[model samples]
Target: MLKINLQKKLQRFTLELDLEIKPAFTALFGPSGAGKTTSLNLLAGLTKPDSGKLSLKQKQFYSEKQKINIKPQQRNLGYIFQESRLFPHMTVKQNIEFGFQLLTPNSRKFSFDEIIETTGIVSLLERSPAALSGGEKQRVALARALLASPDYLLMDEPLASLDQPTRLSFLIFLKSIYQKFNLPILYVTHDIASVINFADEVLILKEGKIVGYDKPMRLLAQLQTRPLAAGEDITNIFKLEIIRQSKSRGITVVKSDKLEFVLPHLDLETGGELLLNIPASEIILGITEPNGLSASNILPGIIENIYHLQERVLVEVNAGEKFTVEIVEATVERLNLKKGTPVYLIIKASSFRRLS
Candidate 1:
């Protein structure tokens, strides 16, 4: 278990953390300046807290009262930042070996071949960092981190620079790494979509305080009742079974327990499952169904609840499954939508992204 009870006085707010983390995938989610990164820094020994205690598996990393502070190198943690931060002048292999070379033979846990093969960077070992793509550089960074054989992993928006598809692919690989290594991960991000199905537990931070902690769906359900932070994107995730496929029509039909929708052509077998992502902002709520529409997905349901943000509103509709839709205030008033009102959700086929 990883325990943290720390306080740091920043210029704008006093960061306070009181949490226990198990050996699983835990996400630290918040908007910008919410102190997500600060918390990671404190745990990694990069920043000192004003006062508190930090420990992992009963090993004391920091103790203000005891006057004990461990150096970053001695903490045995793998920290991956948004940037790959690889040495540009060195080859990928050399960069990855930099840390491993420092460790004595007794301290090494994984062989170089095993780490490179697991990270899928064996072929790119001889290439320089300048020659690697964004994904490739991140792969090398991950390989380098794994070579050190840290007790736990700290990721600070590691997938922020990648595109949506790349992010999805990298996350899939990260999940495999997590399962294979059995290492606890502290993933920090401002984007909720990245942690929907990936995080075992999510910690919501606001103004340098731990505001909420729960599973992804529970926290997301609770978040619908209040206003979201600035630039926060609420992404809905669903794993639906494939009903049929039409290659000539360029579409695939999928169904949940209560709703069936058409998505763009996916080269997957029928009856197999595919994970889908649809952002709240991408959905449009209609009072009634209309004809001659381009979008193929039109789900009808009753508005179970409504929340008013500053300029936008989030409406929860129960259409076989719960969906949180975002719309402007004017649209809500023009439609005269309220609790128990019937509404149609319109979504474009192109708006859906496959997670797996």
Candidate 2:
């Protein structure tokens, strides 16, 4: 478990953090200028907090009032930034062994061979960072971080640079790490797609304050009924069961209760369950059901709730699962969308993301 209550006077706003993170993986998520990175820095001992305490697993890492501030190196936190930050002069093998060599022989939690095998970097040990691809470098960096046997891994956008496929690949490895190892992880990422797929607990920050924190599903449910932080609407996650497939049209049909939707073809079993996201902004609503529409998904369901935003209205429709749709305010009045009013939703095949 990690407990932190930090406060610092930044140039613009006072950066504050008061969180008790017990999950193996906690995601620090928010808008670009929400001070997410600053919180990570404070946790990693990179910045000194004006006042508060930081501790993880009974380890008192920082305390401004008690006059205790552990150095970054002494904190034993394996920090992985957006870049690999591997040594250019040394070979991959040397770069990986750099941290392991610093630790006393008795403190080593994993052997060199174990890390090499676990990270699948045996073939690239003799090569340099220049010779490695972005994904390979990240793998090597992960191995190096693990070699130190850190209590927690501080990953700041470790997969931000990688493409979707590469991100998916590393996500598997990171998920394995989260499951196999006892170490905790504080992952800072802007990619909400990745967050919903991997994160257990999500911390929402606005300006410099901790706006929200909860299990991903619960937080998403909360957002469905109301806005999260700074009028930000959460994306919609649906657990759909693939009922059939069409090779000619290159699409798969999924069903949830009475509603049926079609999406781009995915390599998933027809009878199996798949998780996908439809961003709230992508949905188009209508009061009357129409035919001959290009949209692959058009289903009718009653509007359970409506949240009026600045210029838009977030309509929560029960089209099988709770589907949150963001539409213009005028459309609300135009359609006479009151609670319990029936409505239809039109979404394109491209709007759905198969993150699984």
Candidate 3:
């Protein structure tokens, strides 16, 4: 278990965050300058709090009363920054071996060969950092961090510097590592997609203060209460089961308990389950069925709740246990919607964002 009750005042922002995280991967998510990095730095002992205590598994790393402040190097944290800070002059093998050399032979928690295989960088060992692709370099950097035998790993936007394809691949790789290692990870990212797929729990920060910390699905469902992106809409995740394939349209027909949707060319096998997101603003609600509609999908559900925003109304429609739809305000009144009102929801196939 990791517990933190820390307070620190910066020149412009005062940071106060109190959180207790279990032994699972927790993500720190927020906009830029929200102090996510600062929290991680404090945990790693790179930044000391003015007053408060930090502990892991009941061992006090920092306490104001005891005046116990551990140095950064002694904290046993493996930090991977946004950029892969590999020594350009050294080969990948040398870079990875550097940390292992610091540990006694008997005390090394991970073997060099295991680290290399875990990160899939065995072939790049002899090459210099300059010769590797962006993803390869980041993989080598991750391998180097794992070789350090740290108790916890901190990743600050590890895929931020990569291109779209590289980022996706790296994310898949990161997920595999998370499953295999069982190491406590404090991953920092501002990307909602990353948070949805990677985070076990999310910590929402706004201007150096914690606005909300909970499971990702819960936080995402109540996005209006949290500090979300300006003009950005909420995304509703749905559990979809592939029903059949439409070869002529090059799409896959997926079904939930209350709805059926056609998604573009998914590679999922029949009967496989997948997660998808539909933007709240993109959904349209209607009291009666319409004819000759261009929309490809429609579902019947009852309004579970309604929220009035400054400029929009957010409606939550329960579409069985597998799915929910969030529709905007103007349509709510235009359709004369009410709680428990059975309504037909329309969604375009293009609107569904597939989440792995």
Candidate 4:
């Protein structure tokens, strides 16, 4: 477990942090000048706080009252930044080994060879940083960090410079890292999609203070009014199991935890899982079963909660599977909707997209 309570005065606002983090992949998210990077610096011992306490299990990093502060190298933290930060003169193999050399003899959990194979950099070992692509350089950086045998990992927008394909590949690798090490990870990024797709818990910062922290969907719910820097709706991201697929009809059957759904099929294999994204604004709700409708996908569920927007309402439905639907306020009054009311949902096959 990791704990923090720190205070710092930035140029824009005063930074106050108090958080208890478990061993899970977490994202520190906020707009510009919200102090996400500063928090990471504090964790990595790259910056000192005016006053606070920090601890990781049996070890202590900072205790202002005690006048005890650990140095950066002594903190046993793996830091991956926005840039690759690889040595131009060194080959990929040398860059990674440089990190391994930082580890003390007693702290080496993984052998040097293990880090190389795990990160899939064996083929690039002989190549210099200049010869590698942007994505490849980042992978080398990540490999170096892992080899440090750190107790925790601090990543600051590590994928910001990569293209879509590279970013997805790196994300898959990130998930594997958690499963293999079970080390607490603090990921800082401004990309809403990256947080939604990767983070198990999200910490939302606003005006230099933590506004909210929870699982991705709930955190997004609490921060609904604050649009993502890019105005992306990071809602209703589901990992659904594919039950059956019909290539001829271009439809697939999938099962959520509670509800089974029929959706337009993509080129995905059956028996595997796929990421599905349904924007709240696209989900439609109806009071009664449709008498005649062009949309073939209709689900019956009960209203679990209702959130009022400026002119729209977000209706949360529990159909064994849960989902959020955005509808106009006038519809709410017409249907006399309230909690526990059974509502039918209409989802055009085109509305939901397959993420993976």
Q: List the candidates' TM-scores in order.
A: 0.70, 0.67, 0.69, 0.75
Error of 3 at 205 (Å): 1.7
Give me the runs in candidate 3 sitting further than 4 Å from their true place. 224-356
- lDDT for 353 in candidate 2 is 70
Model 1 residue 303 distance off true place after TM-score fit, in angstroms = 18
lDDT of 3: 0.78
- Residue-level lDDT tens digits of model 4 in 1-356: 88989998999898999988887899888887789889999988899999999998889999999998999989989999888799999988889989688667777878878888888788999998999988888889989998888888999888888765456557767887888888778888877655665788998888889888887756665666654444455346566799998889988888877766778877677889876767777887888898688775798999998866456567789876777787778988989999999988888877776666
- The residue-by-residue lDDT of candidate 2 on 1-356, one tens digit each, is 88999998888899988889885788887777778778888988998889999998788999877889999998889988788899999999999999999999999988889888988999999998999999999999999999988888989888877876567657756876888886778888766545655678887777899877986544554553233444234466655799999878799999766667898887678899766767788988888897999888888889987866556567778887777787888888887889999888889999987755
Q: After superposition, how far is residue 255 of candidate 2 from its true place, in Å?
A: 20
Model 1, span 1-356: residue lDDT tens:
99999999998999999988888998888888999999999999999999999999978999999998999999999988889899989999899998899899889978999889888898998998999898898889888888887999999998888877677667767877898889889999887766765788888999999999887656765674343455446666676899998999999999877788899889899999877878889998888896789999998899987766557667888988888787888888888999999988998999887877
Top candidate by lDDT: 1
Backbone clashes in each candidate structure, one number apiece? 0, 0, 1, 1
Candidate lDDT (C-alpha), each: 0.86, 0.81, 0.78, 0.81
Q: Where is model 2 poorest over a 10-residue stretch in terms of lDDT?
A: 224-233
Model 1, residue 63: C-alpha shift (Å): 0.6
Best candidate per TM-score, number? 4
